[model samples]
Target: MKLRQKAYALAALLYLEFSNRTRRSSLAEKVWEDSSAEQAMTNLRQTLLHTRDVESRHGFRLFEADATEIELNRDLTIDLREIGRIRAATDAADLATLIDLYRGELLAGVDGLGSEFGQWLSLERTRIENQFAIQATEAALRFGGRTGHAALHKLAERLPYSDTVCRATIELLRAEGNEAGARAAYAAFRNRLRHGLGLEPAAETAELIEQEGAAPVGAQPRTPARRSTDIQPDDTIRPSFVPRVVLLPPLQDFKQASIPRHLAPALVEDVTIGLSRLKSVSVIAPHTAWQLDPFSALDEVRSHQIDYAVESRIAPNFTGDGLSLAIRLVRAAGREIVWADKFAFSALSAQERYWDFTNGVARALADSIETAELQRERTQRDANAYSHYLAGRHNLRTFDLPKIRRGRKSLRIAREIEPEQASIESALARSYVVEWVLRAGSDRALLDKAKLHAERAVSIDPNDGTAYRELGRVALFDRDLDLSLAHMSMAADLAPNHADVLADFADTLVHNSDFNSAQEKIDAAIRLNPVPPDEYLWTLGGINFFRGRWEEALRHLSQMRNPEPAFRLMAAAAAMAGQMDLARRYRLQALKLQPDFTTSRWVSRMPQRDPADVDLYIEALRKAGFK
Candidate 1:
């Protein structure tokens, strides 16, 4: 039967006590421990209602509850109860049956629950593993030959840290006249123990491989030795598992009467199907995703072993002519956003536009997952290509001149290790772009290098939107406006849900004198990322300055945490708005950061469709005390 929250309640009733019963207050407190006492009681009632619904569908109830207590239906056959009955068996057949019935750890990935559930689950898992190890080892010793070897091997895999299981497997292999297999198993286990757990196997485990007869069967399992607090668990080292993602049902808060409610859910279904096509990640089925609460119940979501979650919300844009959909890809571990963007479409857009929207969501989701996977691959440090790439990518985003150079060095090392890697090449190109801009467009060599690396990245992987985005920036700096527009348009088409790409495209549009379109694009980008990077704000400030909204320009620029990059522009905006004191302060800050500042050099490097715009900027800068 398909059970949800009620499953945990059933497990507690079945296994927590010998009577298969619990006080209603106690059960509520355990399962809904994070909620208030009154709320917990309410939740308990709702959970039991859910159980009744399941029972109606399946023809029988698993739970019997009263006003004061909840109990498992005594007549129902439960697998866990059956397992509990035979947990202490000594017979080889009974123990073998128990081993076969036992699955891996209980509630395997369900963590971050309430404290009471977390404690109970941990103790329960330990109890099961401990009992299963003893019984399996005993079973393997009693049932000799190939069957015995198989039993011990299964036990070893289930409890890799168990020295007793390892010794048993090694001896069983030797007794079967497979000394080579025995030695190989010993070597593998020893390496895992030393490297993975950072400790050596017991002396008895080592002696089995050197001499031989048997490693002394029927020995009790060893309690794990204490280790440094910094050591991570086994799952952290195993990066080979495929990442699982769930596309949650979108939150549709449409105030517009014309916008249909079905549109958001339809988009979610389309994106889910698109994500399922990618083999690198596994997509949770739509039925399951729909049943999950996207905003709340994250602990229950993580219980399904979801590595990432794609959450979306749909609403009408400020302009009533269109609908806006915001999408965010979040890492389940830390609940950090890996990527997020907003897409705007007309209420009655073409079917192809919807297809384009879903495609962009899928592509960006895949790219973000790849980057997050790289960041998680920190176990091997410098030797791992992923580590180098992550370091370069992280530093490159800082937008500092020296850090950009350092980022370049790391990305170059990553490229050497994985020659023809498109991600590294794209990042290398971005580093050059940042360095070129940071140097105030004086470094022509940086643009050429950026173009070269971007082209190589495109050649290596034409689908990479980041490569096209970098190439667009290079062309913009090179004064090739037409080429820059084409490349930027292509980048946006390829990754429509990429906020940075949209913001960059908007910046290019501002230089091309498309102020209205640029404003719309920047607004959408900001909506995609509620807490935007300083660069996005800087771009918005520039767009406003060019559009002659000096007050708006100053307002946007003032929001930047580090306004040093745009201090001169801020000064100009402030002066034009008649805030002479603020303007002079900003000018002093700019000169403090760059004493050699001159309006002539800055205006000459500035890109604008009309020379008049540059003249006006220079005029404002002069008023703000710039030489």
Candidate 2:
């Protein structure tokens, strides 16, 4: 990259990694600060010349490009991309590869890299390292005996001071029928600790090694810890999660009795559908509220748990030009009028009225759900694919795989039309996540494609939640819990009430061994939409298992009719609860569904909250007749 080209590329990547949907002018400003727009364009042009495969008008395609925008190249073999892929792999070799691939901080030597970009890269690096340490420790514990010992030893050598790895070494020795050796290992670790850092082992670690001299035949399993009291249930009933609403039919006063009777209901339906689109608000059917006929509108709002009540009136213009409409938004809890507005528009034909009503209602609801100060601009992308992508996204929420596939296809077409459309690329990437979860092998390539697309999306529109959400899914699959958490949290902050955003956040929390917080989030998800799919319920069961509430887990797991791989895994948890018969039955059923199901495979699937929990699960699975 030439100096100017390098500056532009660096600026583009910085914006891509940090900003949300940056405009060309904004990017130009950053690249050519204090310079005129013409100069900025000149510099941008120079930057484009660095990319050998890109055309001049393509606007520096990081991934791909089209007429309006340039995005991060999805097929580009960037270091961050490789890091994400390697981090997600479950196999030891993949983990090793990930450690190797995460060579240094992203864009390490780029002089003009913004502080925000530097911070993001720093945090990402920390998360990757933490995950690497945790996984290495778990591997050491799992492969401490027989031919696996060398792997464990290697892992210990790589992460010398990791308490988890050190403890794993001690446990491994004990498992191999080397009681004296186990004691010696623990003593060595203690001596190393005292000599190197002059600190004692953690309470749990000290207890584990205390009985080292006369080590038992087998390692005793540690009991699950109780949840701390600081963790409380998130039952805050905000206006956002309320499902019911009441709308007074628009009352019209006209001198001539020529008004259509059906007009009011049509307007009511329009408003209802518009409000319902907002995940936060659920509008009560007009018919139900009309039938109730309370003493006053406020009474109706109080009785129905309605968060907002809308009342409207229409009047014919005496000049025979237009109709005037008045609308009011009232707070149900306080019976206080929050916002009242009036709109006047030219009298329309019946067909125009129908379209106007829908558009008007949609705009109003959109305004209502939106926070007071917008954090990010919700400007429509200059790509037709965005519309198709949105429609596909709506369908994906229903969990209809056929519909999701169709949506993915629509996104792909959109991608073809506007290849650099970050929004579409993000949507396309998320579709891959769904496909991957559903076991669609043909769509597996989409996962890699999705990561690249998501990276590009973020590059193009760093502030867009969709891109972050897609990237988070990729990170989750890669088992990079830290990156997953960061991305998911960003998505949630950007779109707080979005169901999928909350669900992904909850899932990451579960994987990170924060089950208490995960339960709270799952509860929030259920409250956001009472009837979440079976997968969400299955995750709830996993949360219960981690929290040591086996019966609760079994209860939730039972709700899943067609058992997924995750549901079958719950059988091992059932065994931990001493429900051996039930565990055995579920295990057999799971094995029937997945003949390859084994203790090792099932244990590996589990999110390692506590190493003892892993052992408990393995022991339970073995007892339940799984190999």
Candidate 3:
């Protein structure tokens, strides 16, 4: 679809094509078929040159040609080639790759030159679709028991017209006793077929509807092991455990010898950049790490959910140009020093020297962190409830309903296993608070559920900021602005370096009509969270909206991963700015998510200290067609 020119599209189809390598003459015939032989040759030559130029500008070599033949670059990897390889391979390990590679119809709606190219595309598309059908069927049977039931259902939706895939997915879900899921899958497929292709699924698929499984649905923490044992695969969802590291600001006068103040920040920045480049470790952004002094650094690191701290201090030697630097790699959880060393280097005035020193330090630190994490993992114990709690926390960050429900279930299991885990309790309570805010028709019952767990969590551990944060969010939605601010303020005081809490507090401030304070908190949250979660965008968008920056608000909302509620918000902002057509468009988009959504139920109780802002919000909602 991105192909700009007719020639370029044809060239791509031929060069990267499966099972057909175009001869130079055939390519010329297809692209310039109407021209004379001489003219065609000239056209082909110019097209290839221009195609090569386009590829170069994009920084990738996609095609190569000899005097008589053209082919895709041998070194370059393409999904079609990989799919072919996976189809031939018998190894089950490759099935995952196969399923992922079969990402919709090959080139979807892309068209090619003249009749020859079109014919080739049609044949290839059919071939690829059949192959994917086989792969998804095989994978569904293979991995259905290993994970959730959504995988197969999603695969069925990818090629909705295929009776083969639809039958396989429906059967899998039915076999798992998920009749609702099977019926939902069938209906989704039926809808796709009717709307997208103006056809229905096979009559056999109609039979599946009576049996069930048709609905489509959408939507971490802690701990230490008690003993040395092999780590078992836990029945929880979490990212692969990788060591997260943070670099402290280098101390300039630990030895009571002075170095230039600016030099420490610069060298620390260089070291942070180098560490960040290591693929094995997640480095805390230097901006957040800089907030930590040596006294409070470890506590802050642990609160940020980082595993290791690269603590370093530089001191000038009294008599020489050389500076002495001490570095320690610490395990944040246990406060254990995993690795430590000292070195001497000349003051790096030359850029080359500075890079050489910084790169070495980074590699060494990264290597040490990796080794330490591996050592810890090798001695890890059987999976515990804490593992599930951590998994739940990770899922909660996704900010979608399916994931939220999945996470909440994990936390419930965790609490059942370890009733005393304050963190688990807090996390479960927060899930309720989040559901109350985001989900349609949220009621006081959800707040009651949140209150029980949050209070219990706070009772169990009075210092836990997460419990307070959940309480704060609940109060904010209830329009108790003063109560909400009080609780959220305490959350920040207890966990100042926590990006999640800070972002939530920022959102609360916006609802309370305190835009300036909200801006400051949101900025700090962004800096603290190097990889800020999608929820942060929604929070910042709210701030922009209340601050009378409609376009900026829309910009933020547009970047969200799930933009339903955002579209509703965008509609209001657009209408307030007198962009009625845009408002209507956004309103229609939001209605697709919740057809009966009304401003009264959604926004009437919004916490606001300013009467004018409240009136403005009401006017905008009406203007956006919200009843």
Candidate RMSDs in Å, in order, are: 23.9, 28.6, 29.6
Highest TM-score: give the candidate number.
1
Give residue 598's error in model 2 in angstroms: 2.4
Per-residue C-alpha lDDT of model 2 across residues 374-456, encoded as one tens digit per residue: 21333444334444444555445435678778878877776776676666777777777877777623344767877988899
Best-matching candidate per lDDT? 1
The lDDT for every candidate, in the order shown, is 0.67, 0.57, 0.64
TM-score of each: 0.46, 0.45, 0.43
Query: Model 3, 165: alpha-carbon shift in Å?
Result: 61
State the lDDT of candidate 3 residue by residue for 1-627, as single tens digits. 243555445645674453346677756765665566678777777777877787889898766778988776767676766776653545445565566777775555665344435544543454466666666576567666643244455555565556567777777777888787677776776666556544444434454554443323210222222223221112221244446677787655433344335455555554454344344555666656766766456656654556677766665543465676656666554344556666663333323333444454444544666445433322211235645665576567555778888989988987887887677788899888878867753578888899889889989877677789999987877778899999999887765556667889998888778888988887766645544556778877787788889888887777766776678788988997788999999988888888877777666656788888878888888989988
Give model 2 RMSD, 1 decimal: 28.6
- Model 1 C-alpha lDDT per residue in residues 1-627, reported as the tens digit of each score: 134635654555455542788788867766776777899899888878887887899898778889998887888876566566553555556655666666776766665545445544644554456555655676677777766776776676667767668777876777778887887787777667656644445544555665765543322111133444221112221133345667787776544546646555654654554344344555665545766765453334444445567776665574456777766666553344556677774434423334454455455555666435423421222234544665676566577888888878878887888777776788899999998888877779989899999999999877777789999999888878889999999887765545577789999988887878887777655433434577878888888898789998887788888889999999999998899999999999999989997877776677778787778888899999999
Better of 1 and 3 by TM-score: 1
Model 2 stretches with alpha carbons more than 4 Å out:
1-234, 237-306, 309-387, 398-401, 440-446, 602-609
Better of 1 and 2 by TM-score: 1
Ranking by TM-score: 1, 2, 3
